[model samples]
Target: MGSQKFAVLLCADDSDYVKKIYGGYFGVFVRMLEEEGETWDMFRVSNGQFPEDEKVGEYDGFVITGSCNDAHGNDLWICKLLNLLKKLNGMKKKVLGICFGHQILGRALGGKIGRASSGWDIGITNINLQPSKIFSSLKMPASLSIIECHRDEVWELPPKAEVMARSNKTGIEMFRYGDHFMGIQGHPEYTKDILFNLIDRLLHRDLIEESFAEEAKSKLEANEPDKEARKKLCIGFLKGRL
Candidate 1:
């Protein structure tokens, strides 16, 4: 192949912090996953901008990003995005969903998504990986610490979907629907600074208690997410190297 092409269906708006620090959420994702000769384009699905039907097949794979909006909500844009996801699935196009993306993917594929009974799960968490041929080419430990910030999760998996990873705070932390579609509930694209900034935003918005914010920050100081490994896993899937 000459070069791989990819698109990011961004479902979140970039905060001023992210725009200044990482060039925006789109930039955050590209920094983590972009490879030489690969092309990355973004569609702000959060703003109702999406690839038209004629444009969907131009890329090798698609990535769905986290959003502050509830994935379980039936907003007009959300429904449109779900339809696009259904189309992509029918085509067997490779799709990677993270955070809100993960939850929405579950709903779109005949699963269930709801408020996490554990409430918010922030900071770093270690997820136990399951053995699968899809992961054979990449080196991974039994458990990998990853960045997490979500209040909703996949409550049930779609038919034929297999659980790939889980953490104490959430069940179905990661799942796969056939070889072409995967959903990860953590933020593999987030940097510590991004999480720090996010905590500040949540605090300002009164979405989290100060004590909880402090606790999440403290956890961040203790461990780092296995970002490189996540990068490899995502790239491998998109490029057929998995």
Candidate 2:
């Protein structure tokens, strides 16, 4: 038991999608966690290739990233992964979910998720965190702009989940599951350059319309570079009573 490390499970569903969408930002996040004297590991659970039930307890914490697939989609791997998340939450392990991870957390807690109205893909946007003990350590802006590129949002929260943040465009932007789990609907790990790359890929793939892509590109470019602050917020939130 002494040799066991304080591990963090990175639940990755789509390799290509994460590479294309998150790209270098993922590395930045991992490095930030490492800098905090934590030993974390990523588990690429794409296409239902997660470990069997016996191996799940190896992790000390968990962080689920966004996926290209919708939470409501009939993906067996998604369901299984969410089930595992529920178990981790029940055990009161530290867990954080971002974007698609947020939606999956909601689903695992008996909440519902679905496509957004007008099928709008929220790019870089500002989110306001509600006053909570989870954010007391850091002085955050009343409204902070962050990277986001999701078409689905959580419509309802699970029984024990508490809404922690909100945005004008998306009602439920952040949530907390009991005490040990937190989820955000935006990518706090993204830097400006990485966001540019993601927008470029989306444009090249025709996943986003030309007009929206151009607008989003301009907005992200104009936004202030604040990755460090957001990363601090992430660390602070996790360090809070959990």
* CA shift of 126, model 2, Å: 1.1
* Candidate whose lDDT is highest: 1
TM per prediction? 0.98, 0.86
Whole-model lDDT values for every prediction: 0.91, 0.71
lDDT of 2 by residue, 1-242 (tens): 33332343344533354466555335645755544445556566544555457766765666777777787876777778877877887778677788888888888888989998847655678888888765665766667777888889999986677898898888898998777778888888766666676677777888888888888887776776456767886675555432
Candidate 2 TM-score, C-alpha based: 0.86
- Evaluated against the true structure, the overall lDDT of model 1 is 0.91
In terms of TM-score, the best-performing candidate is 1
